[model samples]
Target: MSERKYQPTWDSIVTHPTPKWFRDAKFGIYTHWGPYSVPAWGENTTWYSYAMYREADENNNPAYHHHLREYGHPSEHGYTEFLPEFTGEKFDADEWAEIFAGSGAKFAGPCAIHHDGYALWDSKVNHRNSMNFGPGRNFVAEQEKAFRAKGLKFATTFHHAFNWFWFPVWNKEMDCGKPENQGPGKFYPKFHEEHAMPDKEYHEWWLGQTKEIIDQYAPDLIWFDFGVFSLMEKYRKEFMSYYYSKEAEWNKEVIVTFKEIAVGQMLGNKSTQFTFAPGTGIMDYEKGKLNNLTDNMWITDTTIDSRSGWGYVRESGYKSPERLIHNLVDRVSKNGSLLLNVGPRPDGSIPEEAQYCLNEMGKWLE
Candidate 1:
């Protein structure tokens, strides 16, 4: 076993190299299945719940009108109401893993938590999780087990770090203001201008939820959404240090990925103060493809939905399998990996269009 010594400082983490497996494993699958998939009407993202709450003209806002016609007003039928309806009755982790494995994906997993603040795992820190509230199933653990059983690297994506600020509209009188409906405050936390930056309590909660996931699933790859740059410096350092240390103890080479904002420079200074230093982990481009090859290893995350959305839509315009396969070839030629996303319906069934794409990719690979 190699000596395990990694301090939390940037100087220490910067010395860590990208895992060899990730560099070689050029294809992976990421799923965006959660409460948002219930609504599933966004353009290319899964922010319909939050976007519907915005006060926009009905003529210009389809999401808002759709919400009103289908589920009533946001005040009467808030996003939380979707929880009870999100009973993943058809969810089969083993089957989903088999599809990913058949797709020639070297790794696969779920977006464990999106900006909606609903955790897919059985989380003790946050009460509003899949295990306790929606599906009554530890989806994260199931995927991890199934993926590993299929000899695929297990990964998990976290977007909850931004939930604190993502749903500011929920704090309004028309949303979670009514006495009977104030309960969502636990999930959609009230945010004011003064509370722009998350306070100590929120930071602690973020750290706790992250630690819980790490402890429970031991995901081989942990991916963070863009808002991680807003996290407090100490909390960020603590997470990286703890994750690196834990991987060292397990005698495994794991990966931690972040968006450009988390690692990019801002206003002439380094973002996160180099907390997520270069060479410490992989850099991910969301729904973006690099134009040219680079010396550094990177990954592109795009959706198979021709509509470009990452969640399930009633009519998800799926891209052709040939296009996706060509993208995989292009990415691999440039020393990059592709993390393709598929959104499942509320009942946990993968769309046939997505299945078709995956099957075509499998044939091409063979």
Candidate 2:
């Protein structure tokens, strides 16, 4: 596919200190905590919602099936059942914040929403939210309060844009070529035709969801996942306006993250394009270190896992603490930040491997 084309018009008008907090902070944690993580079952839970619907062989090595048996099929022991298990009772926000601080993370926040369309905060538009359904707690709100109390800037990452297009990949209801006459559960429906105002509804609903997060939690940063390219120019402007207005009200700067492919358009001749431009980040290259950091500041988000999976699964092995410390130092020396990920279990507890890594990171930072 050809590269996406975007022309942004609002950078100087909506500027923030670029080489400030992000440059000095040096490290931040990207916590992929969600209802899916509750299962703590397989290597594929993070991608489970998408990988499950495809046949066992088709979805690039199906791990969801293994997840199903490990936890039970979604039909019998449905994913929803794990919600009650995510009591988050053992999750001390302050303690986590302290760990982040000790680990030298200048900021920390949870995945406010992922491709499954669930919100971590108290979202009025989406009933399937952490505050109402899963843990029955305002996870984002609580985290923000705790991080702020510890003097760390709060951030929120949203993966919902991918959910719209990505969710359909697994859901039989929306898959193309399915017969309309077929019964509901057997095959997917003609979602575009059946639903009235699908675009308007989803776009509005997504916007409303962001509004609620900004209003309630006041995130210092709002990171968007893939599919932002799909949003129309008008909607993008509207979204930027909303974000810039809110940032001004808070009298603080913010950083928005995007994948490397999407960064150029988002940052078009303007600061509002991204908190830290995409491609500005770095990662370890097998041959050697990634050289020539972008003229603009960037970040490299990596995991300790040597495997492809984001979370802990059987046989998952972590990189040596020495390697991770060196990687962090390499990025920092090149004027970049390392946004590390920690895949927590479903019950809101950090896995032992993750904790050990963070503890080691703390010692290195100290």
Model 1 vs truth, CA RMSD: 2.9
Candidate 1: global Cα-lDDT? 0.81
Per-residue lDDT of model 1, residues 1-366, tens digit only: 134466777787677778888888999999998888877776844888767777688777778888888888887788888877677899899999899999999999999988878889888888778877767899999889989999999998988887777665435555654444434435455444535677787788888988898898888898888777677777887788788778766788888988857334643565455436667788888877788889998898989998778988887688899899999999998888999999998999998889999999999998
The Cα local distance difference test for each model comes to 0.81, 0.63
Worst 10 residues of 2 by lDDT: 1-10
User: Which candidate number would show the highest TM-score if scored against the true structure?
Assistant: 1
Error of 2 at 229 (Å): 1.4
Collision count of model 1: 2
Each candidate's number of clashing pairs is 2, 12
TM-score of each: 0.92, 0.79
* Tens-digit lDDT string for candidate 2 (318-364): 77778889988897777666777777666666767777888898897
TM-score of 1: 0.92
Query: Where in model 2 is the C-alpha error above 4 Å?
Result: 1-8, 11-19, 41-44, 67-78, 168-190, 193-198, 262-289, 312-315
For model 1, the run of ten residues with the poorest summed lDDT: 176-185
